[model samples]
Target: MDINNTLTIDGAIKEFAPQIEKTSPLGWSWITFLSVLVLFGFYGLYTQIAEGHIVTGMRDNVVWGIYIVNFIFFMGVSYAGALISGTLHLFRSEWRKPVIRMAEWITIISLLIGPLYILLCIGRLDKLHNIALFGRIQSPITWDVIAISTDIVGCIIFLYMALLRDFAHLRDYPELKVPKWKKKLYYYFALKYHDTPEQRKKLNRTVDIMAAMVIAIAIIVYSVLAWIFSVTLQPGWHSTIFGPYFVIAAVYSGTAVLIVSMYLFRKVYKLEHVITELHFKNMGIILLVLGAFFGYFTFSEYLTKWYGSQKNDELLISILFDKYYWEFVISNYIGVLLPLIIIGIPKFRTIKSITFTSLVVILALWLNRYLIVVPTLESPYLPIQDSRSAWVDYGGTWVEWSLTLGGIAGFLLLFTLASKLVPIVQLSALVKKDKSEENRKSE
Candidate 1:
């Protein structure tokens, strides 16, 4: 199938079919690399399970370590996916079609991976069910549990709805060169969608409804996560702004991830025609706006703490500025400002430059999550007066670092496998839009 053929539904199927039907040698090599990281992560998990929390850097004073940081970071990314995709769909943005599927995938994949970190954080995994069995209404933990559970279901439905037309198209495509089982899989999931006007109306309506619901759910769920910290009596946490603060940060990081994903898929799949420089520029603008808001929120948060001058707040701020000085600067200052500079300057807003800036934003946001989790724990309300440095300071051990890498590899691996199952770009939407334009030209 010549990819340069005029834009049509059949042409799109032929163009995207190779993505599903065959894996290149480089693709297999990438998969192997990710698999190795995942296996190593599993080994780390096994060691943690066998040896208990003693082997980890977590102590009584610093009970939450990188695991909690990862949990919050991944959840933030997931919520950002939900917010961006939903808003784009609601507004019926034309440029969003190519990237929306990637955003949806980010939402589902991050949701799957994010909560696993909570399990890693729990010392007693055997009694994990107690959160559900003996949960209280007033508990933020309980709220998070319910909110995340609801969010997973909502996002899955939203993604499935988004994919339905593509599934039906693949199922019906005579030229689709895939295994019988794969075809059957598509047929079953396609739900007898025949592209009729009625079916189209119903599908569009359902997708629109799910989009709105997931957006609302994502906000509520992340806010609940923030509340889990804010409602606490601890310094650097008991603030009124943490909810909005977390939400803004999540969207900022999520936008960066989405941009990175778009860049990778566009390059790998050779989708320059579909995902153009304009898409990157549009997304970069969004990232710039988010970066500015995130920076403002970070300043507002710390400025309040510094001005209020409570002893615990003072101590926590001092720890952040003194002990975690480099991290504080990178995450709050460099991470936020660099992306703004890259995107704000017209000369620097090329696709490659924006993508590089996004990568920096991602690392900075991860560091931001670390800063939020670790330094605050180090400066607890009741200080641990211990001679042992391990008791006083928290550092991620090899096991924690391995698991973190593994979680990241797992996210990438899932995205890789998902692309093999369906088109990363929404082929149906693109074809439909192309047809609409053609019709208008004919008229």
Candidate 2:
């Protein structure tokens, strides 16, 4: 069982076998913590179901609240994952192999969780089916439904294609110490793949096609989400730039998330050899570039509105500066600038610093979505007279807060469970790369 024999399935199994077999106490602890949060979130959901939207802070004047913000933020992150994974795979970037699995996982898990927030936003659970059954093609909500469904299906196919070879390797490896049920699962998913030349050719072609399709679908889907807001008559919402603006912000936050996941997996699994500083450096450069573009979009969006000085736009801007001043500054300015500064400067770009910058960007992006949703709703074109402050202003209650935290925990829990099931790094890719390098050296 020579693990150095890169030409064989044995190499990949030997290298990644430990990850499948081992779970640290720390892993269990983290899982337990996430489970607690998830339960708490369910409790909040139960309360909301029993007591109704009255348990939440959403009101007639400000209908959209934290739930919508979370919905947008998660969907943005999911789209980001799809875009990054598909683009990297299409371009055949060598460095992408290590982190690509995480990106795909982010896409699927976030896609699964994000739409639940929409259900939370809906006051009537019984009428949920009406959206699909009676949905108008002319409506933006219908567009969103169609786009999300298409994107998720494409992503799942792409991810499954990407995983097939690895699944085959795991199934064939006699030394793999996983349970019999797990082995059967792998064998079932592997689809009788034996890495024959014909099989390889077909798999590669399918993956390549799926990769290209997912990229196109991801952009269109996320753009459709932006159109949902931009098509509305609200003051801040009715902007032509929202489509590309939202896309840029989504990729920005998604890249930050990829970096954070890279850091965590590398630290926890002791994968420093596989996920190296060079990978961080390359990804950090990407983060920096996206941050710059995001900053430009932010500046352009506000500049156009401020320079135009329409009465409704002016009111929205005033609300942003006065009521949401800190959020605006932190999300638009500090969130966008600090990552650029940290990653752009050669001296400050340590792995820890980059990870911290990513954490900051994630929070800032969430806040960015919050500002986008709440303030615009608060400063409606027609004011509701005789409304109380709580009714007029949007604020998240304990229930919303609980569910938000639960969503984050659910993401972590899913990712953690996924790691136990499959090697976080793409084992088949590593094996192929190693074999190629060996052939080159021999020649």
Candidate 3:
């Protein structure tokens, strides 16, 4: 397959360059809306910092409140970036070309925002640096700090490497009508990339190596986060399966996230040809498999406890199934069942339906995490002998809710800006993948 037959370098520029060169009023409005949410989040942060932790609903019994939930959720969702891009690239899947760049961007943005929740959870922000200075080697917190730092660096390097060829393409292509400043920006990041045969071979090898490392690091980092919870004597979390369980759940939710993103970008950019029905169907199948697996993990986790009937474990299960009955049913039963049914049915596998299913899965997974954290804390092995009603009730306060909204808004804002800076789709990779596929079919 000739390069021109699969994808003319200039033709790709003609098609995708305008995406970066042009801006819509709707884009501005969306950015403005996200900015408002960020401002509100900042106000909530200020109030919490000024008023102290007392303003929030957290108490001695439920010391870990919504902030911890946000931390876990953000960290978990961040897995979508590396796991999707790294896995798809390693597998040499051609369909991944249209979406991998966006996936990598999500990884960088989510990783940056994930740690902010930890900052929010800390009572004393001024002493945050001291953790690195005097952190004990024995503490899981220290391990988490190291893992997160390492993963972020790895993600950034991998993303930059992926972007190099694309950046060079944008820099050299004149038909894109790119402004002078943008051309210079591209030129700077492109690093004199001239698409030489030697350069291409070197870059491909580098990307292949980085993709493998990212996949390994992604699995290890999330498992480390899970260990922080499981290592404790907490009844619900103390299990041998928590590590793989967290990794699976992350992939499950992260894939759902990637589906949602693909839908939005495809629809908005009028990229019906670039991201097609086949992409959605393939991703839907992946989602279906993960949903079933997650269901199995859920059943196994609780079933083990139910059979043993340990008093504390039973109490925690009761809190989950009895007290939080609706949440339990919704997240586990409805959440799992709906996706399976919709995806399993060929008639219902439309882009809109798949996107709808992703929204449900994302929200339900967040609720699942909430159930995991709060219920365990509520039913400590030693009963809450306290007389105070506040000690028993652990509903999150308005400040926490506001900050949560802010986090969501901040994530979207970063994504929006990044999209404008670079073509969300990797034209370079798409062309190369298409050429390879064409060659294979001919052979």
Candidate 4:
């Protein structure tokens, strides 16, 4: 077998750039609709930020609202695109060629929006900025700020570097008729790839350096965020496994997010040829592995709490299994278990079915996130100090709902616009001078 024939994950993702805009129009309208909604979400967010966090449901105790959850989720999701895309690229995963562009772009855009949630939560621009100007070195919050900022820079650079070859293709192909601004962006992004023997060597070396940087940034960002929780005195949040647990959970949720994205892209862009059943099937395998990993973490977490016989842990556990068992168990089983079984089946391996399962699993995971986050705040010590008249429920008010939907809509909108503006798949690099069989395979 040829040495290059074996293929690794990153090598596969390199294929995406050339074919990005080549697909049919499947997702355009939906993405357009969501883009408009994102505009609305931002409008609302702007007003809320101006008015203050008082406009939302978050009281003193419930400072961590849905926005925080979404923020963390977004940050976690960013990890998948950053680490998965860049990490695989560093090692050269052949199957990763098609997906890495989406993953990388997804991370860049996701990280950009993530900070907004925290800003909204704080609702004080002056106070937030003060932290930067006079931020304490020792605070986890400070570390989080530094970590995410560094991550954002790294993601943008890594994504731009990955786009280089694709930009060259767009420049070469007249049929694409890529606009002037886009061409300009592509030119800069391409960073003058002459594809010379020495230049190619330097390009590869540069990509390697960026890959390492991206991976380190992803790790540091997530670890710092986890520290934000573990540093707190909270019962469930404080744990040693919280670091890797956060990373694994981030990848798990992030993959589900990518699947949601894939479904939309396949539908909107009509990339049915590029994004095949094999893609979803491979993602299912990843989700299942993470599912198992999450399961073990959950088991160990609960077992330790049970063994320690902590009152706070028992109280929280009792509240969960006894009262919120319906959503809780359903979310876990359907989100975690059902996908594993579906993917394991030979007949269910088709893309259509796998896509369906991915949606189900994704929805279940969303509910699971709600269960994981909201319940803890609800079951706080001292019986939720909120008066009976106050909003103590683990849900968003109308404003929160509008705003949350708006945030989600914004994410979709950015994704849609980016895919349209540039080749979402990174087509140029993936077109092999030879090894045509390398295309369409999943990592």
Candidate 5:
């Protein structure tokens, strides 16, 4: 074998496989911790199911609660997977290699867990099938259903296609001590991908086509989610810019979560060489731009309503500016400002700071979603005639809080198991990239 090819193949089998082939003590502890949280989440779900929606803080006035908030957050995070992977592939960005597999994992895991919030929101599991049976084109909910379903299929295809080469690598590397069942699984997933020049060309072409398709599909899917809110007559949600606003926010939060994940994996796997400062800088820059876009949208959204002074819009604005003043300011202003400072100021742009900023942005964006959903519902144009205190204010109950944490745990659990099952970095893609760079340098 040629020296370069030998090195690439050796690295794939030795470096990448060892990282994934076994679980560490820390890994087991992490899984157990997440499992405990999931159990708590299931218990909360049981109470909500047995006792009804009353266990949640949602009322007739404020119908949507933390469940809807979490649904939006998870769905938004899923975009990080599609957008980052698709954009990097399209541009052929060198920085994307270290993080691409993690991005896809985030997307797959988020998609799997995000919809559970909807199930929680539904209150009655038996009526779930009614969505498909009675869904109409006129409803934004119907549009969301179709969009999520389509995106899930598209994401799975992209993820599987991306995994094929890694599967093939693991299959051929018999010394890796992988279980017999896992070896068989890898063989099946690899689809008998024996590495030949012709097969390699076909794989590249297919990935390119799918990458383009997924980018478009992911954008539309998230936009449809925004439309689910904007199409409504609610004061805060009824805006033409809501689609772009949502898409931007999704990318923002998704990127933040990606950075956080990148930091954790880098430390745990000791991939200092593979995931370096340059990747953090590039992703941080992207986050900076997104944070700016988010700030602009936030300003525009409130500025328009503040200018118009429409009674309903004004009331909604008051709730955001006055009642939920701290949350709005923190999630919007502080959230955007902190990241901007961390990324823009050259001195503060360390991996640790970037990851910290990302954590803040992720949490703040969740609060932003909560503010978007609840406060608007509280200040309906028609005054609250029910005269119930609970109907006036909606604070999430223990059941909602527990289930929210559970959903988060579930997302973490999926990602953890996935990391163990496959190479968290796409070794084949990295090899091809390295070879391309070498060829260019030689030329």
Candidate 6:
């Protein structure tokens, strides 16, 4: 058996590309499903905008609710794609090469969805313009918009530049069997890429510069989210350590998402060998380390509050321990503890086990987020003396649920569609063998 045939980038790309061309029942089913979900999400968003945020749980005091939390979580998850890709690419890790494209796009697409959701939650779309006009440079929300946008732009540039080589291959190669427009795209991007001594040097330098910028910008963006909560004067949120705490949690969840996405893509595209059991095992270890760190942060955040015994802290901590204790315990156990233990064990560290563990961690992270947003506002410093007590801790309504589901589906759908467009995995090294040869000749 030719391992090269099974393991090669050309082979995987060739096979995966046909997934788009498939006109069969299941292929149509995915198209139909994605379309319906997106439409439903879009309609829900429109209705939401029409009715205003008042229909949702958000109110005067608790202006930032699930939407903001979701924004932060999505941004963090994108970081998995951005930072992990950037770090691995920078270090020249071979394991990262096959997956970096996936990582980079996930960051870009999720970053886009995250901001839209924030806008949706913000209700009045008209005032968004006012943000720029009166937008205080010092505001965390303004900083968030700027940082996330900059990071998204950086990720896109990095992704497009990296994929340029593969596009060149599709343009030049015989087997690609592509259309005129696609051929045009290949030729178009190929212009920036000649395998000359000068061009190769320029390409390498550009990739390095963009990769470095992505890392710096991603870090700043993560810090921007941390500042969202820390900049506030709330007890659990006000700690100096809050910024780093939020960043760690973001990475922990973001990495879990990448694991889940990678696992899904392997199955969906049947690129099992390319994705491999080893990738799962290695990433599982990464998650295990992150879970441990998350556990530490969780312990520290709660412990300091309970120990300090300030009046508000005391109220919130007691309520958390006693009243909201169930959500508290379950989120920790399934999200953090299970993954940590399962991944830590040699026996359970297989691909299937890791995938299952990753789902648990991701779910827990979602629950963890909901708990954080709802409980803090529920236990505000002032007591809720109102007939509409339930409104105080606004659980997500169906519209919110539909919108959120639609957004998540949209992210996954983008992956599926994106896989069909460019080299889902970069193949420039093989296709560009000619370029490399030309560069050598020029040298």
Task: Name the 10 consecutive residues with the lowest summed lDDT in model 3.
Answer: 432-441
| Candidate 5 C-alpha lDDT tens digits along 42-115 | 99988988899988999888989899999999999998678889889879876687789999899889998998
Candidate 3's error at 440, in angstroms? Answer: 27
Q: TM-score for every candidate vs. truth?
A: 0.96, 0.96, 0.94, 0.86, 0.95, 0.91
Q: At residue 433, what lDDT does model 1 achieve? A: 46
Error of 6 at 372 (Å): 2.4
At residue 199, give the lDDT of candidate 6.
75
Ranking by lDDT: 1, 2, 5, 3, 6, 4
lDDT of 3 by residue, 1-443 (tens): 22222675656777777678887898889999999999999999999999999888888788888888888887777776798899999998977888888889889988998899888878888999999899997988899999999999999999999999889878766666767888889999999887667888999999999999999999999999999988999899998889888888888888888889899888878788888888899999999999999999988998998998999999898888788999999888877998899998999999989989989999888888888898898888776765476786699898999999999999999988888888888878766444432343366
lDDT of 4 by residue, 1-443 (tens): 22223333234333334334443454556766787777777777766767766778776455677777778878988987787787778767666665777898789888987887887777656666799799999999999998998899888877877777666555544445445777677677666665556876877898899899888888888989988887776667777887887787778777877777777777665567666666777777877788788767767877797788788777777877887787767666666676677777777666666677767765665665565566667656666554553555555655666677887787777886788666566564455552332342221
Model 2 agreement with the true structure over 337-402: per-residue lDDT tens digits: 898789999999989999999999999999999989988988887878888888988789999999
Q: Show the colliding residue pairs in model 3.
A: none
lDDT of 6: 0.74
lDDT of 3: 0.86
What are the runs in model 5 whose C-alpha is more than 4 Å off? 1-7, 432-443
How far residue 171's Cα lies from its native spot in candidate 6, in Å, is: 1.7
Checking candidate 2 for backbone clashes, the offending pairs are none
Tens-digit per-residue lDDT, 1-443, candidate 6? 21222333444446555643344576568867987898888887877877877666676446567676677778888876778888887897766665777778888888888887778766557778998889899899899878877888888888877877676556555566556776777788777565557876888899888988887788778888888877876766777776666667777887888888788777776767567777788788888988998888888878888888898888777767787787778777667789877898898788888888888887777767766666677667666566365566566766777788788888877877777677566665323234333544477
The number of clashing residue pairs in model 2 is 0
Q: Give the TM-score of candidate 5.
A: 0.95
Off by over 4 Å in 2: 1-8, 433-443
Clash totals for all candidate models: 0, 0, 0, 29, 0, 0
| Local distance difference test values of all predictions, in order | 0.91, 0.89, 0.86, 0.71, 0.87, 0.74
